[model samples]
Target: MKKVIPYIASNFKKDKIWMRRTKPSKRQYQVVFAIDNSESMIDNNSGELACEALCLITKALSLLEVGEISVVSFGEKTELLHPLDKPFSDNIGGSILSQLAFKDKQTDVSGMVSFVVQMLSHSRNQSINFSENLQIVFVISDGRFSNREEIRKFIIEAYSQQQLFVFLIIDHPKNSNSILQLQTISYPNGKLTCSPYLDNFPFPYYIILREIKSIPEILADALRQWMEMISSSFL
Candidate 1:
């Protein structure tokens, strides 16, 4: 009987049965916001709207077990407003809004996208189970940007890596060529796929936002919809 007890104890220890624990199957998501802070954003108060939108997004994510978030602003240069290293907070969102300066004339969309892609890529590479994580990017802009080809290349790369890129173009009731150019760059075939009555383009990712007042509702809806899609994929 003593020999039998010792044998069972040794087998259990070898298998490490006591170390087993259940891990939740819920998917984790990493979100990044690339906000445009160019001079044009000052015209319709879009910069402030962008900041409010960020607050709404962070608030929504706080309700879920979503992973960390990062915020980047682009104008004359791309800058990291909120880094992923720090946890998200409403106070942080307020701080980001206070720092917004719409003085730059250039919106380097490509540079901003490149930086986000690299940041998320590095994070994924360091993870042991990266496949369980999803990368999502929300680009809020007035659509006046430079480097069309470069932006398209980075967008394609992000999509190829299974990252979700949602482009929210703030259209302030103008027949602006800059907005049209940005639409073309974002479209897969280099052509506009939306119309006046349409909010979403042929692709599910691109959306045209018209009202600054409805920023919170619109962003919350988009985030919820995308999260649903991501969750469904796991089943």
Candidate 2:
């Protein structure tokens, strides 16, 4: 039989050891997610898909122990569905996701950008601890704008902050003649790239329905994958 060493146990209080190892730190990050809710979005048949995408992102972000997220939606007008000054709430995420189906009658990208600028400005002024990581603004749209000048100003301001990560989710090719020029001009510095169109876009459903009918699932999966890539790179 092999001889075994006698076991040793500590008598020092358990509470002291637990406190030493599990003391919480003040290292939380703020991630702002800005989504579009314009009239065109309603017609794209992607409202539900967009909502699902937002839900997935929110869910994924919730997994991070030191990160906080804010959700905002925009169209001809902007609304702060969830504020950054508070902790993440599942109820808030669900409510904001539901708004994807509530469309605006007009499409105004400039208005949306303006709203984002104002939100960021306020956040900075409030001295919120966004950490040294990044303050992301994920813009999910088809790249259509009404006031190019306003948008330009917004982009310049956001980029000047040097902490803004603009993720443009271009789901489809521009079909509007009025937006064609703006599309070419608004492309960010090598940061903007085209991704697959969300399956719910009404244009392709009739043709592709027989093959894959669940548009929400497809788009959600793509968005989730994109978000996972972002989280892995950042977090």
Candidate 3:
């Protein structure tokens, strides 16, 4: 008892031993997903693959507990499957999958982009400096849209708002048409290069997937690279 008392008294007086203080993370990551639900997605089982990819993404985000995600499906009209205000959970995959279906005949890219832009704009209006917010919108489609010019206009608007748009084109491995279209739409005269892994981008970026099953891993890797890029910029 005497020995314990002396040790306690010495520690209190010296104030040497204590738990380390840690600061909370200031970085905010907001991800928005726009999936194509047109008839083409059903033909190649693209719809199913997209659902699987979304499930995997939610699972990964749940595990990391680093970011919040919102999902929307677009065809003739836009449908919001998940909203940002809703908290993420591990078992929400099944619920999400049950809500998605490929039934619409037309791909409404412009409508989807406009909706996402408004959502981001509203969120930004509430904050003072949104520089810490990393806003990324992932569009999973077969590179087919109803109106090309409208889509281009919205893409520029998104860039002006400092939002990065990633187009994940669902096509065969040998096809390059979608890649070329993405480059042209995002950068008319500017030349953009992309590989299978999707690296290096001055403006918006894209990825061409041969197999639908690889969407989860590829998207996860892309997010990791973006995070690393942001971290290094601070150093």
Which has the greatest TM-score? 1
lDDT of 3 by residue, 1-235 (tens): 1111222223223233322333445656678888898888876556766665565555555544456688888899888878876777755556766666788878888899899988987876776656767677878876655465677788889877766788876764444443343432234468564343222232256776656456545665565665565456522
**What TM-score number comes out for model 2?**
0.59
Off by over 4 Å in 3: 1-23, 172-203, 224-235
- Superposing all C-alpha atoms, what RMSD in Å does each candidate have to the true structure? 13.5, 13.4, 12.3
lDDT of each: 0.68, 0.52, 0.64
lDDT of 1 by residue, 1-235 (tens): 1111222323213244323443544555788888888888987556766666666556656433357788888887889999876888878887888778888888777888888888888888887888776888888887665565677788788877767789887776565533443333235578656443333232247666765556545655565666677656532
| Weakest ten-residue segment in model 2 by summed lDDT | 1-10
What lDDT is obtained when candidate 3 is compared to the true structure? 0.64
Ten-residue stretch with the least lDDT total in model 1: 1-10
Backbone clash count for every predicted candidate, in the order shown: 0, 0, 0
Indicate the TM-score of model 3.
0.70
Badly placed stretches (over 4 Å) of model 2 are 1-28, 128-133, 170-235
